[model samples]
Target: MLKLSNETKVGILTVVGITLLVLGFNLLKGKSLFSHNKTIYAVYKNVNGLMPANAVQVNGLVVGSVSNLEVKDKDASQILVTLTITKKIDIPRNSVARISSDLLGTKTVQVDLGNATEYLQSGDTVYAATDGSMTDALKEQLNPLVQKLQGTLSNIDSVLLTVNAILDTTAKGNLQDAIRNLNATMRNFTHTSASLNGMLDPHNGNIQKTFDNLAAVTGNLKDNNQKITGILDNAEKATGALANGNIDKTLQQLQQTANNLNQTIAKLNTTDGTAGLLLNDKKVYNNLQYSLGNLNKLLEDLRINPKRYVHFSLFGKKDKTKPLPSDTAAVQQ
Candidate 1:
């Protein structure tokens, strides 16, 4: 074994140490010195939790890392971040760089390559975007809820103050009185409920009888539904007949009959017919009365002198005895 001098040993150690340091620094920046890569720039208003050495991925595959970050403008409102991508990765012209975080809050840069045939060069620029992490998202969403909770708490405090002021007044007596009234009302309601329960208890037949009667009525109605429908149909038919001039025809016929009767009464009153002559002519009436009186006298004479009418002679002794007109007249008188 050859022994080296101290200066030479120190020089060799320094070179090895510098090499290790360079390798460590490259590893910390997520860089592989052995592999070829390209660099691109992205400008953003906010990088949100992005840091150097964070993985730059395309479609969830690790392609590069965030190399460096700086303020693009003097106002420091805009940040320009450098991304070192693999040389073999062909990024399209319209690619987008977005900063996102995982569930562990580890930030990353995700590249969404467009479908354009034109590709981005090594020193091309990209527009930067940010996606809120779980914490930031929750904070943004819960901000209104927090404000509403604060308002609710403030309202509750005001209500408590008002309630305290109310309790400090002599109206507490009225409140207590109202409470007592409410208790009394509650007791009365309890009694009413008990009484109602007694009336409607399952063992009691009153409610059942009512239900049975209702059921019976419903059954009767159901059974007689066709009969009722028939009656209604008949009534509708009658109403339709009345509405369709049947009643009018009846009234016309009645009117015609009444007119005929009125004409007959006029004829009777004017002595233009037989009934009219008999009812209105006094001379004919007197003649009828005299004829009836003469017929009655003739009938009476026949009944009294039946022997004169029924005379019989068996032998031929021809002695004829006849009734005289004067004797008949005298008898009539």
Candidate 2:
């Protein structure tokens, strides 16, 4: 190898320094000189401060950078932006590249992947959109609130004017009196709150004692759960037994008995049967009465004249006193 002159060596060093400087600058700008990156295009009405070398992110991760921007038409009505993706991600053809900004106003191209099996080629155009910047978003969010606040202020102004128109010296005095009453009501409410707090205190309150008593009752109920269950089970079994009994058959029997009794009563009300005749026929009743009287007299006679009825003399003589009614009947004959 031939040795170089000082000037040539210096020139070579200068070129090498320049090349390294360029490489360093590109690296700082997030560009890989040797990277096999994919290039895609997008058209937008506004880029919203998207610059070349701005980070192109996919799901919040920086995968590439914005490469170039150019006005698409003579009127500058739209812009064409070029994006370089260094990763091997399969971006769908329908994917959108939205220009977004952070809180610090650092803009980025956020890639929103789409659901399509067909992927974008290196030179394909992605759909472009501009997300509202932080300021724009804040303005959009606060506009309604501002409108409502303005309306509220106007309504309050109107109310103030109305109050000024309506409130004379006497009305002002009454208003002051009302405010004083409200303050007193507030004081009363404060006292009531203190009383309620006292009622709710755990150490000294009747409410707390009532709660403790309720807790003890619940504890007792829980302790006697088994006994209560047994009682309920026995009651349920008794009710089940009653439910399963032949109540319909018993009712049928009772109804049949009532029917029979009713038939008996009906027969007794008629003079067709002997019982009916006895109960319902007056002639039969009189005859029965007479027969019962005769029976009673016969019984009394036997009791009084037992010797006439049963003669048992040892001398074999009859009771010859002329049977009681025989003499009287013979004289009469």
Clashes of each: 0, 0
- Give one digit per residue, the lDDT tens place, for model 1 in 1-333: 999999999999999999999999988987778887789999988888789999999999998899898997675788889899864889888889999998788999999988889888889997678887788899999999999999999999999999988986587988998899999999999999888887787667578678878999999999999999999999999888779867877999999999999998889898888788889999988899999978876766566655556766688454445565646778999
Candidate 2: misplaced stretches above 4 Å? 167-333
TM per model?
A: 0.51, 0.49
| Model 1 lowest lDDT segment of ten | 316-325
Error of 1 at 331 (Å): 69
As a TM-score, model 1 comes out at 0.51
TM-score of predicted structure 2: 0.49
Q: Tens digit of lDDT per residue, candidate 2, span 110-208?
A: 999999999999999999999998989999999999999999999999999999977989899999999999999999999999999999998998899
All-Cα superposition RMSD per candidate: 15.4, 19.3
| lDDT measured at residue 221 in model 1 versus the true structure, 0 to 100 | 95
Q: Give the clashing residue pairs of candidate 2, or none.
A: none
